[model samples]
Target: MNIDIYSPDAYTTGIPHEQFKWLRDNDPIHWHAHPEGGGYWVVSRHADVITVSRDFKTFSAEQGFVLVDDLPGDILDMARNQLLGMDPPKHSPLRRAVITRFTSRRLEQLEPAIREIARGMMETARNIGEVNFVESLAGDLPTAVIGSLLDIPRDMWPQMRRWSDLQTSASDPDLGGTPEEVNNASIEMGTYGFQLACERKDSGADDLISLLINQEVEGESVSEAEFASLFVQIAVAGNETTRGLISSGMYELIQRPELYRQLEQNPDLIPGAVEEMLRWTCPLHYFRRTATADAEIAGQAIAQGDKVVMLYSAANFDERVFDNPMEFNIHRDSNPHLAFGHGIHLCLGANLARLEARIFLEEFFREFGGIELTGEPAFIRSNMVHGFKQMPVRLLPR
Candidate 1:
């Protein structure tokens, strides 16, 4: 079966699992033709994806981070400046300037605040028995947490969520924005971000925004334009993907009542359960890297400047790395899922995302004695983000 996995429509129906397995087994480093222009090598196996993610010299994000189709020149230039799209010698120092804030100790300190936010959300959810879980519950906390961290005023969060939702899922009608609308959102968001950075530039605030504005790279602080890109990255990246973890993770539980029961019986298992959920639902399908030098993977030669896409959702199910890869077992130990990725460009918010998911599950199972799906769950159409746009469910108070 010759399926165009690159097409976002391929994911509109659902994740093509069997096709990914076929690619992994037959052509782990398969070549896929892009309708717009150049072709890219699809790295489907876990080991191969790791190799491409690790060898920064061989593959470069600055060339074009995680995009198979080339973006417009202006958009591409801004993307290259973000931490997610930079190469070494440049990526390392910028990352170091802010890594300390996202460490386990720092995030753990924010647990009480996160739990308070989760508790309040659940309390509100208790009153509305039947609701769209995505809008009502899953979407708010990530924005709240990140907003608090950035010192963005509470009043501005709704708009922040709207911009992020539009930017991340532009292809889905449920979350549609015209190309012009999408571009305008980015411009407006960046402008707002620049304003925030300037306000905090010398205020001595300890939030993430202040750190980025105040901290020096080599000898110079981050430029306003650079911080604008970083701000949008942090705001959107922190919200959408982490919300996917909560929404998609809950969807998995509702379908598997047996697993849900098992988790309810033993709460301590939640940390691992969150890990299993992450492995089972690869939130982001893939991220593209450009080959900076000629390299061969699984005997397939790739030329410099070629696009190499790492298929995370497909690689997570590789039988070679996962035992009974199709089965969902919460007790599955030693899960090395690439949901947060596996390199220096690895998700900076990995710890915070995990903490939020774990705490969310703990609070959810504790608050709702019974919950059931009332309508079909709909996934966002974009292949980049694997998340629910709408999931209707009824909740019963304890």
Candidate 2:
């Protein structure tokens, strides 16, 4: 089949699974041309993706900064500070420091706050009766959770979500503005975070921002500028991916009523169902890594400095790794989907996202007797973010 994997339009209706399947079967390490000029290698198979993710020395996230399109020099410098775009040694110490805030114990302690947020949103949903799920319900919990963690004012929560949406979904017309506006949003958000870090320094406050600002990562405290980038990473990552997980997961469950009822009846199965949703939704499509040395992946020649992208959406459904890969099975015995990615740069908030999702599902089923699609769900126009931009749904309160 003809393929235009780079085009945002290709993914608007849904994931171009057919093209991905074709690439996986025929050209697992396919070379695709970039819009700017040179091309990049797309790694489709699960094993190959894991291989690239693990061997960071071979494929360096810091080199190209994890996007298909290269950022400008100044922007690239700031992007490198993000945990998503850092190499080891530097990446390790910082990841260790920040990860402490997202540890299982911490997430467990934070569960009540997260549950309260979810329940409140569900209550609002019940009152609304019919509304866009993405805007009204699904986006609130993550935004609020991140806000609470940073001790951001409740009033600024909407602006936080707006900044995150502009940065991550710039390809979506409804959600994003002009390229200049997108760049400005990043700058504004970073500036706000930088100011926060400066204000919180040495204050001995207990919020996540203060903890990060005061604590010594590797015998040195985090600088305000570094914290600015880190803040952008955490806020954007927390907002976009979790929102996608919750909204798209609900959309999937809404489509399968029997499965939905099954999950509602047996809430214990919700966690497993969340896994299925992660596998099915696969929030972010791909993250690019530049090769440090010459390499060969799946017998395909990969020269030094070649852009190699691990296609998570494709790898999650690899025929070798998953049986009946296309089908969504909550009870699938073994699921090692790369939704949060793999290896050293694996998402720091992975467990927290899981906690949020599980609670969101539990509270959702508890608050609403039933939910039906009021209109066809509309996907955001972006190759990177896989989610519903608008899902109009009517809720029946129990």
Best by lDDT: 2
**Per-residue lDDT of candidate 2, residues 1-398 (tens digit):** 77789999999998899999999999999999888899999999999999999999899999989999888787788889999999997888888889878877888899999898888888877887998998888888899899999999999999999999998899998999998888888889889999999999999899999999888877977889989999999999999999999999998888889999999999999989989899999999999999999999989999999999999999999999999998989899899999999999898988888999999989988998889998999999998999999999999899
The lowest-lDDT stretch of 10 consecutive residues in candidate 2 is 70-79
Candidate 2 residue spans exceeding 4 A from truth = none
Q: In model 2, what lDDT does residue 231 have?
A: 96
Q: Which ten residues in a row have the lowest lDDT in candidate 1?
A: 6-15
Each candidate structure's TM-score, on Cα atoms with residue i matched to residue i, is 0.97, 0.99
lDDT of 1 by residue, 150-255 (tens): 9899999999998887887888887869988887787789889999988888888888899778878678678788888888889998898888888888888888
Clashing pairs in 2: none
| Model 2 residue 104 distance off true place after TM-score fit, in angstroms | 1.2
- How does each model score on lDDT? 0.87, 0.92
